[model samples]
Target: MSDIEIRPARFESPEVQKVVAEALADLSQRYGGSGDDTPVTMSDFDPPDGAFFVAVRDGTLVGSGGWRRHGSDAELKRMFTTPAARGLGVARRMLATIEESARVAGCGRMILETGYLQPEAIALYESAGYRRIADFGHYAGEDGVRSYARDL
Candidate 1:
């Protein structure tokens, strides 16, 4: 298999938006909302506090993920792999990029919110050493939402 390459990306860039839109569309089908109601903006992924990234393999955008500072933790966001790229380690590579960037930026831990509907994502996180944590941020107290965290 060709290596997956990950690179920094502007959240507002069309390429990033295209992948993000695909992720949101997939989430919408499973979770019922478009995820547009959240406060995640381009500015949230700006330098010093956050970073966004895209993953490509064999010239195709395969996955995307990012980390935004939330107190002492880096909150993971937009983590998704294209349907065609699933099980190819695209998401795992993107996640490693996010975690390394977050650690470099002084974050001590990584956190994320996923839903019960996304068993694959939950399994991935669990396999990566993430453990259940209390609901956080916009997911706090929201039914069906689950949070996970791990030391970086």
Candidate 2:
């Protein structure tokens, strides 16, 4: 595989929007309804409070993810990799970059929510040292929702 470059990105940029849409579609197909109903804003991923990242390989966007400030912790969001980019380490690279960015921003831990339908995502987080935690965010207490956290 060619080198995958992870870079900071604006959550609302056209490229990012396209990637987000793809992620939503995938989620919808997996768990039904208009995908994730969690509310998010561009400012949530802006600097000083949060950071977003995109993974590119050979000049094409392959994956994206971001982290938002949650007290002393960072909340991961919008994590996804293009279907064609799967098994190429695009998602893994993007995840590492996002985690480091949050740690550098003074976050002492990272948290995230994923659905039970996403076994791949669960595996990734678990392999990276994340462990199950109390439910959180919009899907808290909802069936099929799983939350995880890791100390930075």
lDDT tens per residue, model 1, 34-146 = 85356797888998999999888888788898989999999999998999888888888888889999999999999999989999999999999999998988868988988
TM-score of each: 0.95, 0.97
TM-score of 2: 0.97
Compared with the true structure, all predictions reach lDDT values of 0.89, 0.93
Worst 10 residues of 2 by lDDT: 1-10
Candidate 1, superposed: residue stretches over 4 Å from native = none
lDDT of 2 by residue, 33-62 (tens): 989999998799998899999888888888
Residue 131 in candidate 2, Cα distance off native in Å = 0.3
Best by TM-score: 2
Evaluate model 2: give its lDDT: 0.93
